[model samples]
Target chain A: MKKWVPTVIFLAVAVVLIVLAIVFLPVSKSVWVWIAALLTLAIFSILYRDNPIYRIAEHIFVGLSLGYGLAMIWHLALWQIALRPLFVEGRFILIIPIAIGLLYFTRLIPKVSWLVRIPISIALGLGSGIAIPLIFQATIFEQTKASLVLPEMFAPGNPWPGIWAIILIIGIVTTLAYFFFSRKEKSVLSPVSKVGIIFIMLGFGATFGLTVMSRVSLLIGRVQFLLREWLGIIAQ
Target chain B: MKRRIPLTLTLVLGIVMMIQFFIPHQFSQDFKNTALEWLRVIGGFAFIIGLASFITHHYTKIKHKKEGWAYSPIALGALVVMAVVGLIGRSPNMNWIPVTVQGQQISVFTYLFSNFFTHMMIPLGATMFSVLAFYIASAAYRSFRAKSLVSILLLVAAFVIMLAIIFYNVLPLGDLGEWLLSVPNMAAKRGILLGASLGGIATSLKIILGIERGYLGGTK
Candidate 1:
């Protein structure tokens, strides 16, 4: 038997099923619905095994994604900001950034490859500079402020909220200590890091469980589409 | 000459941007805004450059007639077709070809472009992510052994959170899960965030000061 035989049989079956589906399936008015439903099934096919149909869908997704991004850049940014300003509006100053942007292509030319660093440096400088003060304010200062105290502490006859706030603070302190403490310094209780480990584990586990559930929800949504939109077996 | 100029640019730009953040002057704000816009413009070019390499990779595969090379044409074809359609065809006034679909008059190019996103992109994207659900469960089953106190705590937290979400209204576990997230999870998150921000700020400072020239791609 030829290796191509399985592929041939699969294609033949797929074509026949598709034809039958077109004829017998309770059709929606929009052709895109059918296409989307078929693509969804193609993606779900990965659960069974990797095959040509899944590969085709995956490649199409990649191509379309890049194409979409490229078009948006052209339409929104490059066109509105750079091209129009350079051409129609006669704002010659915009050429500076466009020229810098074009320098990225210099990477392909080894001798001028050093020029590519111009853009890289600019990007890196911009990103790093912008990140510093923002990170300091948002992540460090704000988070510290939040964990330091809560309005719950002021609630009369409710020690639970105050306790919760205290626990959160301890959790933060111990966790920070865990981050700061050297491995050699981590004794049972002296280093304050062991308790941090427990909280970290708990946090990780909760995160994983939440991630799994989110995936499950996606699966449910696809299944719901198949049943409701494709098969017309379930109501909207 | 090559390294010095780029390094100097990084230093100047970084320091200037940082200093601009502290200034409340109108000129400072405008300078910051224009610099940000320029950054975005350059970022777009960066993306296109990345895509150029992507296309070149597939081209190389096809040129060499490498394994699974037959699929390269499909990938390239879709990319070119979508891009061509998006560039010239998505215009509202571009109904050169008379195409009516299900009683709506639409340009064939515009229709194709819109349909590619709606039919092709969303379905594949969502389903691709959902496919990971199976693998995650399989991996969890294999690794989630409750051998230690930490592992036990992990499993307990996982089960508690999962169960709480699944039967949120029916069980008291909802309150427990919410409290766990608010108190312990928030603590862990804030702790990690604080540490990371400090480290990140240090790294940024290092880069701004040109102590980290690793991005220049050579040992000087």
Candidate 2:
């Protein structure tokens, strides 16, 4: 009774949901929309606590999500991939991908784990190759460009601002030096790195403050829902 | 046989996917998309495993009459009803009358989700996350002490930034705040990014070369 009861109940429900999702969901806009919403709510119940209901619903959710994903892939990729390109066009390039893709499944075998690296190497090399140049452009050159200054200032500019700029330049250079992990710093870079540490803490403090506000916003959203929707009474 | 075939396929597929990104050909893009789709399917199956475990865990809990097992019925009921409603609603040929009139299937599900799920779940999560605020405040008060030159620099910069936010009168200090963010912060952020990039590249290389067999769960 323990095992079979839940299985029977779950299977029955699963069948109904599958039928609803495949057929009726496309017909009635308002009804199926709410069904979708309810399904979301049902799964979310786990946040409060776990129970058979939540477990069953969560399982169904997993099943449905998986089933949908597979269906979409079959619809969109299978014909275009294995059949249209490789089988139809007879392109030799197609074999390369087929071979590489096959490498990912090798983990299932006890001895062929080493063969998996062939594909892993290519992916890593390409990802890094793209990232290196992009990083140099986005970080080093752009920052240097922003820090550029003219000897002459606009007519109404104060020298005080320029003095601050010199301080800022000092801070930037020293702070970057702090992160130079490879070499030991015994020169002026040591004190400069110390100055950089100060800047890092201040920056982190401000970010922590901002995160607090976002969290508050999320809480208010829940409180508002409970009071206004469930109880049907809330202060404006 | 299962192990050998799947492993062989993985090797060939992984290589193809890696090269696809750089191939600049239509076939390559199609192959990449297919690989992503397959990964999504696998991920979906993982979720089903989770659900099965959940049922097993709860069923045992209820049967053993564990503490707080009474709530199991409510949870089980909710799961069953949801599944039924979902199934019924999924059927196009079931006739909308039973759904609309008898059970009010759609509205019942909608009410259950909105009144219960969003109202309860989202807020609870948001509240748990918000606890970090009070924690931060206390931490700052206790730990942000200045005993040396570096600490003092940090203290002053933080004070200036905080003052800029709360009081409108500190107009001049706003420039100090801006300087702290754009100049020093930018430099540190860039350095961190560079280091992270290097780490990611290294990890990716390890995974590709089969040096990082950890992902495949200890060599099988």
lDDT, residue B190, candidate 1: 80
Worst 10 residues of 1 chain A by lDDT: A182-191
Instruction: Give stretches of model 2 more than 4 Å off.
Output: A1-192, A216-235, B1-15, B53-111, B114-117, B148-179
Give the Å error, residue B139, model 2.
Answer: 3.6
What is the C-alpha lDDT profile of model 2 across B77-190, one tens digit per residue?
A: 555554454444433345444324444554443444343333333333354454445565667788778887656665666666666555536677666667666655555565
Q: Per-residue error at A35 for model 1, in Å?
A: 1.5
Best by lDDT: 1
lDDT of 1 by residue, B120-202 (tens): 89889999999999999999899899999989988888888889899888658999888777888878888888888889999
* Candidate 1 Cα misplacement greater than 4 A, ranges: A1-25, A150-154, A181-191, B90-106
The per-prediction i-RMS, to one decimal, reads 1.2, 7.6
lDDT tens per residue, model 1, A31-124: 7888998899888767757788889998988888888888888877788788878898999988999999999999899878889989999999
Q: Provide the TM-score of chain A alone for each candidate, in the order shown.
A: 0.88, 0.59
